[model samples]
Target: MPVLLDLRGAKSSDVAVGTSPISELQACLHSLAEPDHHLESRPWLTGIGESMSPGLGHRLTRFAPLWARRRCRLLLPLSPPLDVDMATELDRVSRLPENDFVAAAAYAVQGGSFDPRGAVTRPGEFVAACEARSFSRGELARSLIDDPGDFRRVLVRTLEDSVDAFFAKEWERIHGRLRDEVEQTRSRLRGLPLAEVLSSVSPAARPVRDGRAVRFDKLQNLTVPLGGNPVFLVPTIHGRPHLIIRGEPGFPVVLHYPVAWRGQPPSIDEVRQRLTILSDPARLSLCRHMVNEAITTSDLARRTGMTRPQVSRHLAKLRSAGLLTSERSGRYVYHRMDVHHLMGIGVELLRVIVR
Candidate 1:
C-alpha cells in the first residue's frame, strides 16, 4: 500500500535540510505524519521505536526519502504447492495493527532507493540502469509495482540511456574517501584486531566466513543476476551475514553488498545445551518466533498471548544460556537468536526423543 503525499501545485524539492542529519531527518519524518492518535497505542509503533537504533535510524533516514520514492509496488510471487491457508494467514497478519510500523520500515530498507515513476514513464531507461548494474530491472520494478511485461522493453531502453558508466567511476572515487576514514580510525585506535575493529565501526559490514569477500555493499550481493529484474539470492549459509562497501556504477555513493559464508559447526554439546531448554513445546515456540529475527518483549507476549511475567522468565533463561542476544531499539528491548544453531539442536533432540 502506497502512502501518497499530497503536494498539489508544489514544485519538486531536492534533498535539502539544514539541521544536523538526525534533527533534520526527524523534522522531515514529522512532516510526513497525518496525525495518527491510534498509532500511538499500537504495538507497531512500540516495535519501530524499540527496534530503530539512533545509528541505524540515522543511516536509514538518509535513504528513506529515496526509498519512499522507489516503492511503487510491493510483490510476493506465489509458486506451486499453493496453500490457501498460507495466504489467509498472511492476510491476517497484514491487517494486524502491529504490521504497519514494520511495513513502513521494510519499505524504507528495501524499496526506498529506486525511482518508482522511472519504472513506468521511463521503462526502457530503468531496464538499462538495472542491466548495467548486472541486474534485471523489469522483474524488479514490476515486482514492486504491478505489471512487468507491459513495460519490460521500454524500461530497459530508458534505463540504459539514463544509467551511464561515469556514475560507477564517481562512486568508486567517493568510496576511497570513506575507506580513508576507516584507515585513519584504525591507525588512531589500538588493541582489538584490525579485522574486528573494521567490522565493528562499519554498520553495513560484518565479519563472515573467516575473511572472505565482505558483503552487503551492493544489491548484487543480495540477489542473483536474472534478466529483466533480479531476485533475492538466498544463500546456503546462515546467521547474521556481512555486507561489504564496494564501489558501484551510476551512483557516487558507497553501496552495501550482503554476503554469506560457511564456517565450522558448533560443538555437539553446544547443540545439546540449546535444545535442552528449547525441547519443551512452549520454549520451542518462543524460540521459533525469535530465531533470526528481533522482537520486543511486549510483542512476544501479545503474539504468544502470554503474561509479561511468563515471557520475562523464558527470555531471561534464554539470554543467560547465550541462546539469545538482546538490544535496545528504542524504549523496548528486542531479542534475536541464531536459527541455524537452534534448528540443529531441534533435529538432534527429535532424533533422541524418537529413539
Candidate 2:
C-alpha cells in the first residue's frame, strides 16, 4: 500500500522548501541525543553528546522513542512547510484538543509493540488510534492508567530546555546555510519537468510506473501518487535513518532529503588510482593477507618474500587509494585491508555510469 502524493498537475512552484526551527531542534535532539547511532551528521555533535551533563542527557533519553528513527507522528506544530512564526506555531500546538492530542500520542508506538500504559487518559482512544494505523490494538480499560495532565506543557518545557542547552546556539549558525541550500535546490529544478524534479529529490526516490507515481526507500518501500496539491522538501545535513519522508496516507507530504546528497559519482582520479593500486600482484597479495589481521610492514614483507622497503612502498600506494588503513603502535605501523571499500567499488563504478 503506497501513500501517493498525487502531484501530477503540480508545477515546480507547488513544491515548497523552508526551515523549521522546531524540526531542527527535533533533528538535533534525535541525532545528537544518543551514542549508538554513529552520529555522522556532525562530527562535533558526537563530542557534544559525550560532553553533555550526564543527568540532563539521561533525562532526554527517557523520551527517545518520540524522536528516534521510528518517531512520533504528532509533529505538526514543528513539521514543514514551516510557519514564519515558528514560536507561535508551537504555542498553538499546546492548545490541541484532548482527543487529537491523545490520538497523536497513541500513534507513536514502536515496532508494533503498543504500550497502552504510555497513554495516560482515555486508554481506549489511544488503543483505537493505534488500530486505525493498522497496528494491533486491544482493550486497555483493565490496565492501571495515569492522567495525561497537559502533555503539551511537559513537552514544551523539556524540549525548550534541551534545545536551549544543546541546540540553540548551533542551530542559529546552521540555519542560514541550510536555507541557501534550499534555494539552490529549487533553482536547479526551474526548467526540469515535475517528474524529473521529483526523481531528483534523492538518489533513493524513483518514479515507478512512468510519471504517475514515485517510490521512496523506507522500512517497506512507499509509493506516493501525485496530484497538483503540494509537497514540502525539507533539506538537512543529517545522516541516513534520521527522518526522511513524512506522509500519512494523504497529501501535502514532507520529505526530509539530505542537502548534500552523498551518492555522487566517483572521481576519475580516484577510480584510476584505486584500480592502479590493485593491479600489482604484490600489492594485491598484501591486500588479501591484511583482510584477516593487521600486519606490520616487516611481517608483510616476510610473508610476501619482498624487501621491507618494497612492502612499505606498496602499503603507501594502497593507503592513498583508500584500500588500506593504518594504525601506529609506537615505532611500527600496522596495515588493515578495507574489504568494505573493495565491495563498494562496484557501486562507485555503477554510479560513474548512471549518475
For model 1, residues 143-221, the per-residue Cα lDDT tens digits are 3334433333332232222123122232233334434433444353354442343344333334444532232222332
Global lDDT scores for all candidate models:
0.37, 0.61
Give the true-structure RMSD of model 1: 21.1
Candidate 2 lDDT tens digits, 225-273 = 4455567777665433333566553335667655554454355457767
Off by over 4 Å in 1: 1-65, 69-194, 202-212, 215-246, 250-279, 282-355
Worst 10 residues of 2 by lDDT: 136-145
Q: For this target, which candidate reaches the highest lDDT against the unseen true structure?
A: 2
Give candidate 1's whole-model lDDT. 0.37
Q: What's each prediction's TM-score?
A: 0.25, 0.64
TM-score of 1: 0.25
